[model samples]
Target: MGVSVFSLKGKLALITGGGTGIGLGIAKTMIEAGAKVVITGRRETVLQEAVDTLGKNAHYRVNDITEKETLPAMVEDIENSIGPIDILVNNAGTHHKATAQETSDKDFERILQTNVMSVFALTRECARYMLQRKKGSVIMIGSMAGLFGIDKIVAYGTSKTALTGLVNALVTEYSKSNVRVNAIAPGWITSNMFLNAIANDPQRKQQITNRIAMDHFGQTEDIGHAAVFLSSEAAKYITGVVLPVDGGATVNF
Candidate 1:
């Protein structure tokens, strides 16, 4: 028997916005797959709770990603204190649900600041080390809104769409250095808040369901599994791809 290609044993992963939801899902799954994970968020309490839930292999850091000036030092500190960051998951983002006409320039710029600029800044910081060592994997958390048009989320869609281009451009530069970059476009992942929102709105639920070819929303672990694959040895040759983890939602009529 040989080593499992999918095994993340000895890997250290850094995930942003990991206090809850899909980020936490990815962290849990990665830990189960044998990686030590550090989760970052703006709230200390939330991060602490998430780490407690994640158990011994998990850690937490409270930092605002929008503070771009701190990212380089933050990355260095993490690497020195924990270990070299073998994987980076750009999972932190802000969503704006408003028509383009209703979304002000400030609203749009805020979305970009969190979703695009910060992501690139952090990725650049981590990639510098990865490129030097010639080993690393970077995963961007994208959305269905980025892949296609959706009403009332122009700003979010733009940010995510930017990630696609970022992944492409970064892969071109980093693949040669053995550092892989990719994006995961998740569609309608179920959460308590989302479930609650739809529970009282059957028509909206049905409309959403009808748009999905699978007629259902996805689970957070669905995204975690995809992240695991993309970060594992199994995907060594894969790069510059935005893999959709949607339940056929992106392709439905």
Candidate 2:
């Protein structure tokens, strides 16, 4: 019998900012699904540590996606050395916490460059090869900040909102070629960063917990598992959709 549609046995996936947090989760899950995964970040040590934990099926590359000029060559190098990238996860991002009134032009622009522009640069470079093959999946890691409004994160929210638009536009241009573009908007996922944010702020933590229908935060694996399903052939017919992995937070009142 043929392999399961969900199995990613021979696929090569490249995930940006995969050395830690949500990106790391996605890398681990993709490896478990049988895909040979390549994770990229600026920190060589962190990337190597994650590769070690993810075992042999996982690999690491040190590249800063924010350097737009270098992206095309980097993609070529990865494809030449490892394999054709069947899946590209635009997961590298940064967040800024400040009101719109307090957000300087430079701050907003920096967030946009990292979260939106860099994602486009990498996706385009990878898509060039995928277009020739007439097959690939592109997954954007979005955020709850874009799903709805929360105070003090104007720049971050704006960047994430842009990703939804990016997904739709890419699918329109590439879906006919069998290349799929979609996004996963993760809610409050449990991670050291998140815990640290809420550690001393009891009120903030309580407010977040109350808003979640599940009455708790989600795990990084929640986002990872969703990414795997969307990247696999199981989701061949799905494109331009944003799957929320937010523990019902977006739906809660």
Model 2 stretches astray by more than 4 angstroms: 1-3
lDDT of 1 by residue, 96-136 (tens): 77789999999999999999999999999999999999999
Best by TM-score: 2
Task: Compose the digit string of candidate 2's lDDT tens values, residues 89-165.
Answer: 99999887777999999999999999999999999999999999999999999998889998888999989999999
Candidate 1 residue runs with Cα over 4 Å from true position: 1-3, 192-203
Q: Estimate each model's TM-score.
A: 0.96, 0.97
Residue pairs clashing in model 2 are: none
User: What is the number of residue pairs that collide in model 1?
Assistant: 0
Question: RMSD, model 2, all Cα superposed?
Answer: 1.3
RMSD of each: 1.6, 1.3
lDDT of 1: 0.92
